[model samples]
Target: MKLSFLIKSLAGAATMVAMAGPALAAAQSAPSPVTLKGDVMLEKIVTENGVSKTQLVEPKVVIPGDHLLFTTRYHNDGAQAVTNFVVTNPLPSAVALASESAPGTEVSIDGGKTWGQLGSLKVTGTDGASRSATAADVTHVRWTIPTIAPGASGEVQYHGIVR
Candidate 1:
């Protein structure tokens, strides 16, 4: 698929919201104290000389079975620390989540209504049988940061494969 379309989809799916503390009470007209930037990278294996290494590079085109890395960087621009900050990202339709995720990360299979660990969630098939949800069924990923000090920055990342 075209890289631009993938980038656009990533941009639309990654949304920064759910702020707590004094920042929540700020005027709606004012800009958000937290700034977010999202990026999608293609994972490639390059062999130089006699050794092989994995690298992440900007994707100009992606095909099925290609591994990808999705990342979101966040920074607190507010004067005071922000607590209970949450970062949520939706998987693109053409991507399937990897089997493992960072500890404390939560995932949603039935849209954004509910979230839990991959193994803890279930999905009912069209045949009327319930089955355990797998990484392929993940639709969204979320991370709740306890606190972000003023001027502090951090990032969260996940892996996926093109469908």
Candidate 2:
């Protein structure tokens, strides 16, 4: 009877460890908390006839040198607060900022891949295509918010000049 109890206890312990393996692995691999927020959220405001809708009403496509306005909002839903963290988005090839919003945001002269301050980030990509990511291929708007607290949100509106 004693031997049987010992065998059963060992088997139960092994089972418990197997069940907890994933939790242990995640704890070990987790990154340390920092000022940067953990999770980011994006949403588009759709309106059939509203002026401030996420969905583009007027045709986004335009002739070269023509400009169109675009808007997008982002929310922080993570446990951390984001400060001086850059937000980047790709604009349609045929768009560019006409003017901009009150609080000016950075525009990356390079494509939408990397971002920087109000200036631009230098890019060096192997793609030789004209639309490839490059410092000269400004197709994005970037901004560093003061602090995007968890559950807080921000927005960006800009112009797109059709190439």
Candidate 3:
């Protein structure tokens, strides 16, 4: 299949070593009140010749210092316009949130129990030292989409670094 070849070709062309395939993409229940489906994805950032780029690849295997991206696509399958849509996603334990841009988005560090902007979050170390939460302490990501017309689709994503 074309998709299988594309994955393999991209894996080989990327010039990175990883035996694993893409991470398992997940779709939590649609944000309530909107008949939409959310799909998740993983992307790898590749820098070559000092020019960096990202490709849609799996994280079959990654180094602790590697940077990655987690994205979600939402499709409005209903016949009505959806408003005030919010999407939430949990980050994997292996990666910390990367300083990236996501308009109208918030993050959580307490297992999705709370949410806030990065500078507003704090992570406490075992040494009794409390410091501002870095990308590494991010445990979840959320996005608030104002509206999506019928038959239209939108996507939201955040970057992260492998721990």
Residue 9, candidate 2: how far off, in angstroms? 38
Selected candidate, larger TM-score, 1 vs 3: 1
In terms of lDDT, the poorest run of 10 residues in model 1 is 14-23
Per-residue alpha-carbon lDDT of model 2 for 65-147, expressed as tens digits?
54445556667667888677565666666554444331255666646555554333444556743332332256677666778
lDDT for each candidate structure: 0.87, 0.57, 0.73
Off by over 4 Å in 1: 1-26, 48-51, 102-104
Residue 88, candidate 3: C-alpha displacement in angstroms: 0.6
Q: Put down candidate 1 lDDT per residue, 1-163, tens digits, no spaces.
A: 6999999877766643333434666756487889999998998989999799889999888999888999999999999999999998999999989775633579999888899988789999999999998889999999999999999999999989898
The TM-score ranking, best first, is 1, 3, 2
Q: Give the clash count for model 1.
A: 0
What residue runs in model 2 are displaced by over 4 Å at the alpha carbon? 1-67, 99-103, 112-137
TM-score of each: 0.78, 0.41, 0.64
Candidate 3 least-lDDT 10 residues: 19-28
User: Could you report the Cα RMSD, in angstroms, for every candidate shown?
Assistant: 14.1, 10.5, 17.1
* Angstrom error at residue 15, model 3: 59
